[model samples]
Target: MAKLKSAVVFLIFLTSVLFQAQEREFWLIDTETQQKKIVKDSVSAVKFLDSLSKNHFIFTELKNVKKVGLRTEIYYDKGQNFNEAFVQLSDSLSSELKIEKQFYTKNLDSLKKEINKKYIDQGFAFSRIQSKYLGKQNGKQKVELTVVKDQKRLIDGFVIKGYEKVPSRFVKNIEKEFRGKKYDEKNLLAINRSLQNHTFVSLERPPQTLFTRDSTNIYLFLQKKKVNSFDGIVGFGNDKSEKFTFNGTLNLNFKNIFNGFESISLFWQRNPDRGQTFDLQTDIPYLFKSNVGVNMNLNIYRQDSTYANVKILPAVYYHLNNRQKIGLRGTFETSTVMDSLYIQGKDYSKKGIGIWYDYTEPTEIELFLYKTRIRAEADLLSTHYSKEEITAGQTRYFLLAERNFYLGGRHYLNIKGESALLNSENELSTNELLRFGGWNSMRGFNEESLFADFYYYGKAEYRYLVSNQAFFDTFLQYGELSSKALGLRPKLYSFGLGFNFFLPIGLMSFQISNGSEFGNEIRFSDTKIHWGILTRF
Candidate 1:
């Protein structure tokens, strides 16, 4: 078996070199004036010739992998010996433009027959020819011969059928992308690739084609597919304040499940103290083929805190494309502060329904570490019958910026920041006090410290891939929340950093933070040290 394989490979190599149209010339002949016209070897470049001679020139008895190369021969009848008359015309053609490789088949009549017959097998007319030279040594009597390969005409029109689910209109629009092209049999087998590229469409079958309109048109048959899926998430956190919490969620979605043009999703999340939520959503796409998707989610939440007590929300989201997204979210929320042993009822929560318009835009930047994508979100909250956020509500102006970076090798980093401008009329809710020493922020301090009017958080992490499906991650963070705005007030800053090794099946979250200011008696309210299985999915 090994010897057979070796023989076959050698045969193929010989054929490839033999077919190369090395030292060959080409010219256009004029039948009426018997004049030879040389032309630049544009399409017949070196690569083109190598591809043509690749399998036709060699003599071999062994059969191996089907030999194939680029198509090079395109002939036309001049009604005279034009090829012969124009033999020397190739020398006068443009010298600047050169052939990458001018390859031709030599001493292989069988290969010519094989190629001409191959064209016919593909539905184009085919034929083979014989040529001989007769003339005065150099400028002899020129004669051009036409080896009649199968003759075929180009296609003019096409028809598509068997399309379901994939809007016919959309398919028709895509078809326009390939209109003035021919039915290359080789390419015909590959043309169906476009259907696979349609993100919204699921292809169930390969395309089938047939000739139409006097071989000038072809009708293609197609079939569309349907699919569906789901996602789940869970998160957990704890701190030195002896506080712990768990959050879990489930999302179910169906695409092209029934109405073909639409999809639906149901979501629910449960959290202790942090609140719980349930949402239902649906969307329709390409109603206008603008690459736009419109969806709506009905949401409800229950939480008893200083900033937000309980909430019932209904939101609509629209994604125009990758760069921008706009959403109008409304919530009927009740805010309240949990009674504490020390603070009593210092925090407050009110019930109110508010509608907000949120917009987020992301831009990419090339950074020294790697490429980073920064996203900014702005929201116009407090619509409908409601007191102005600056006048009564806590936050009137909210702005948040987040950046994600791709670290070279296996390291990945992400940074985020959020700020709010509250109206003087609205007192800061105790429950809204910026918390520290938790899973996300300053991990060294207790998780329930909201003393600051404004706070900042910075974090960094390094990851190492341990296996095809597992990795080890370590992270550190620093955060501060001051009693004054922009952290100028009596600062309750927290500084702590920790690391954890996370795995795919589960994760280990760890942290440690210090809630104190510099130049002051640095006393550790506490050092938070803990680990758990939790990684946002």
Candidate 2:
């Protein structure tokens, strides 16, 4: 009797396992489209609902498989109406799938990210996905999804908040660009930055956007920061050649001179042993909505007390895009040496077509992970002599590249390189020499310490933020001078460490540096303190 009972129990357990292994029919129906999807089992039905969650169908529920005779039916519910600003559901569905067309994806996380990103980019700041399954309907599994689109806002127009002296043309120009457009945060930030960079105006506060019904408006509260501006700088240092040196520069700017996006700048500088200098320049932006502009400058300065240098530069440029620009530039320079030097004066003129590209990837507040700029130019140079009746023609090429990187935490880095080549039919003069040194170049060397017919310099700086507004930095500078006629000069190298304090009003730095000349002995020479101030009116 006991053996017979055990055999019957085993047979029943085997039948139950076989029933669980058999496939079941499951259905997922869209509440809006009434589209039906047939799944193989409860697991497959759950996965189908998971895919729907990508298209803002967050809340989904599956019903237990009901066995009616030999068949089982599974059901699900796609919850709510989450899409409001769309003309078709497929549009949002494609975005959720991360594709250009309506397609299916097996990646659950990717679908979720795409759906969330789409909602956030479309101004659905408080949107969420909620799902639930409420029983079966019509012998098919019924599932529902709920998408809560909290705020779907659009851009309407701009309103001037305060009665400030802002030009109507400026306001109109800004409005025409953003009116009736989507509320894109990136574009709005860019516009705000452009307005802040304006020379004659300052925003009392960042422009605020107001939303009403289906539209939004930007409010501009403005004040005249200044119509005229002035800035000055002073420095004192001793060079290896010269005993003591003092330098000072002053700039005076007049904005909106012609009332059509034009400005004039006057600059003056005094260097005790070198000479006094004056510069006048003006620039005008495009008026026809095309990215075309012109700039002109005239500079006259004395160098080394024995020679006076005058330069005039005029250029025209057209922006190709946000990162690229093409320009035509000319340089006319002349030198006069009546103060009794070995040679008289020289004149050089060059005209070139140049292209410039800049790219920046900001990773955090006032920080960037990648930033780079490339400038390359080709020019035809004409050289003239004052005392000697000699004229030379040369073709020159120049390239400059600068890059910066932020490598997490306090680590910041900057790298720069510049090179110039001159192919001449006649001998080149000292006036055409490429030079580097001093504060802007190799910090451990004197001003223009190294000069050559063709020269290249490379610089790298690594900074560690020691405090909220202070940086401890280390730098390495290298330069090479190559002259076919004069033979290759010795390479230059410099390394230094410094502390930089970025104050609220200006930047101050103190550094001690060691440098080598001509790959010879090493010494610490250029230990100095530098301060600079810049304020926007």
Candidate 3:
């Protein structure tokens, strides 16, 4: 974004005069030396032309003498018998005209001053302009330019490494975005955005390139930095009946395959009403590039001074893309509940192992000028649903997609659509299906707070940012997921608003909603608004 902005600025600089002003003659004044030499370098020549537009010759007041001629002997020798000159074609001596000329002349001198300062600014003692030829014929002039430029310049190139999840050829395609280009640091920064658009990379503000290396290579060297992510959440919270505590997830992720395609993290949350939770997770990717990964999770919970469920699960997955993935997963899980002494059924289901493959693809119809990512998945019984002799045939199909448009600088308008289905004997239900609501989802809703079976929802979020200062986000969600067993909902709706403060201190968020369950009768308290703070290291 920064790089694109600068390119726009540069283009505007070139067009500012051309956009509204008439062309003029080149008033040749040799360099201030005993044997003045014309500029011989393309870079310097182009810069000199630009500087001329800002020099005294163009923007300052012409001397009081009313003659039109080039000044040859030192400064402003208006009375001239000169070797070279650029006389104004029409010598209208009106004060208004002179005032305009003076304004232009003053601007030119200012530009010259800036050009002289650029050398020092760039750590260069001397700048030699190399294109020196100029000619005129048939009342038209031709200025010479050089094809090669040898000016010393510094640029942070785009870096690529450890992309094991993607084919090298695909990475090569992204590398082409920066190769052999002029190292305009500002433009490079903006073009780096292409990384976020790619389906494979996790979205984040990319790291800057290390400054020391070969600046001229087809594949430039850009050393990447480590990544740290913070998750902030506030919520009405859960079916698991957790409290109204602020929940947060801290993720420190990596893109380079150097340390291997793996990630690890620790999590803890507390609430006044509900119990608390401490969980740990680890995931490994590149399981054959079809988006396969291994997920392990263990959670310890307690409330009212008693032990809650201590659940453990290890799941292997195969996801095709950020929008979709298919995996044949097997998990060994066990649990213990806090208040289960009088409970008829076990607080948790014993270990159940199964393999499921799922997939998603975008539908052709465009919404918000974009198509929805369509998907479908089916899981057959690789094993029993439990130690008991019963097997579950699970299948689900879904379509979800989002598109955004810029409202102004930092403010953006986002639109989304989603739908899904679930079949028999599946332990995962509406409560487990994830949607856009928490950190990285709906800024105001709790993480995984609002989703149900066989449902459809849409959301609009307006996010604002102030460069390095902070970012603010607010969104509205209206949709529900339903399931028959949980009496969840086939028809549900919620519309809410929320915000986040993305600052150096980390992230803070708050959200509120007024809606009901997916059923013939909508219930209240079934909905509420909330707030939270979260960060990571």
Candidate 4:
């Protein structure tokens, strides 16, 4: 008897182990017909229920979960009244979704999520979505969805750190752009980009957003940068006698010296042909805590033994945004012929009012100057010729565009184009015509060597970055000009190679270039060489 009992107990233990090893099956049942369908596992069971729910058969309960196989019961009915639930949405949003009085969606949960996203974009940061079942009514499931827009959050202000000396006006301008606007990712990114390439400051990192009870605040960590600079360039060229001559340019810029984001610049240049230029400009980006600003410029130009021209320009501008501005400028100019026998030059005075637009986009890389820059101006002036005792109307237009495109790795392409046109019914004198050449314009030629009433030029430079502070570049330029005084309409081309590298004091630049008329052969004698340095303080 004892042996038989022990054997019985061992068999029972084995049976229990086998039963536990067997996988349990899940089933979905139709309550009315008592029909069932097999489900693979718990995950599949949940998916099956979801699929049925989408088809208006919602699982009411899980039955016999711990028995031989799991079972769930579902009832079939028409889904929720989406039209009633959508009544809570704004008219614009409801129209955007195209929800009608008989609106329906197979995936109700997805619809709810999409609706929630729309609210979030509208500054409803803490919005909630809730759904409830009101049981079957008229052979259809009665359901309700509620959108709980807890608090509408707007941008309250900014909290600045890392750089405390930032111009108050600059901060205020940013506030004017974003304060009281929706607190969303799009606005946050715009705020970040506004500070990315600022002339006076740079972001230490991306901007941060903080949320409070009913308002949002942006946190900015900025670093003050040195944008003021002293730049100089010296050129070696041949004079009319084919003798080597030295010419150079100087630029001194002071920016934000008093922490008001103002700028003052002085520039002087002398060409090999005895021509000289002097320019002084001052700019106040903001005055009296307002977005309106003022700029004043004074320029003097002397053409060797020919004529001298002096110009003064005053402008008032409104900031459209961080990267753009539009302004009205008044131009006053006077010119005097040095030699009475010089028939080609003229003594004249000009008064004009014009509209101008400027745009600048800073490069992502600190080593590069700008990603894109554009300046355009249109003016109508009244010109008085002292020698001829005549007055006439003149229209002038100017445009300059520059862009840098990255081609992966360390390669980049810089393209620039500039054009100017002077239109008048009266004759244009050599002194009044535009002059362009040399390192800053049509490299390889003498400074201000080419004169024209209309001109346009394009330049393309390919660069290979050697380091953050060094680069090697080769450039080609092509242009055409019309000069009535010279009776010439000529096309010109120039090519050059240059390199810039950083030194202990500043950046050093060197270039060798040659240019000639399009149909003329290039000669070694036409080559121009330049060396320059730029220091920031």
> Which numbered prediction scores highest in TM-score against the true structure?
4
Q: How well does model 2 score by local distance difference test?
A: 0.61
Question: Number of the top candidate by lDDT?
Answer: 4
| lDDT (Cα, 0-100) at 14 in candidate 3 | 50
TM-scores for candidates 1 onward, in order: 0.43, 0.62, 0.48, 0.74
Q: Indicate the worst ten consecutive residues by lDDT in candidate 3.
A: 71-80
- What is the C-alpha lDDT profile of model 3 across 280-300, one tens digit per residue? 877665544334577777766
Q: Write the per-residue lDDT of candidate 2 for residues 330-360, one digit (tens) a residue.
A: 8787776655553523554444333333333
Residues 1-537, model 4: lDDT tens digits? 234334433433443455556655555565555677776554565555456545544333333222343222222222343332222344554576566523435466677888888888988888887867666555444555567888888999998999878767788889998999988778888888878888998889998888877668889998888989999999998866787899999999999888778999999999888999999999998878778999999999998778899999999999898889999999999999988899888889999999999999988876677899999999999999986899999999999999999999999999999999999879899889988899888897998888999999999999999989899999999999999878999999999999989998898999999999988999888789999999999
**Candidate 1: which stretches are off by over 4 Å?**
1-308, 322-324, 337-376, 380-425, 432-459, 464-468, 478-537
Candidate lDDT scores, in order, read 0.44, 0.61, 0.44, 0.82
Q: Give per-residue CA lDDT, model 1, range 276-313, as digits (tens).
A: 55677777654465444555655544443423333444
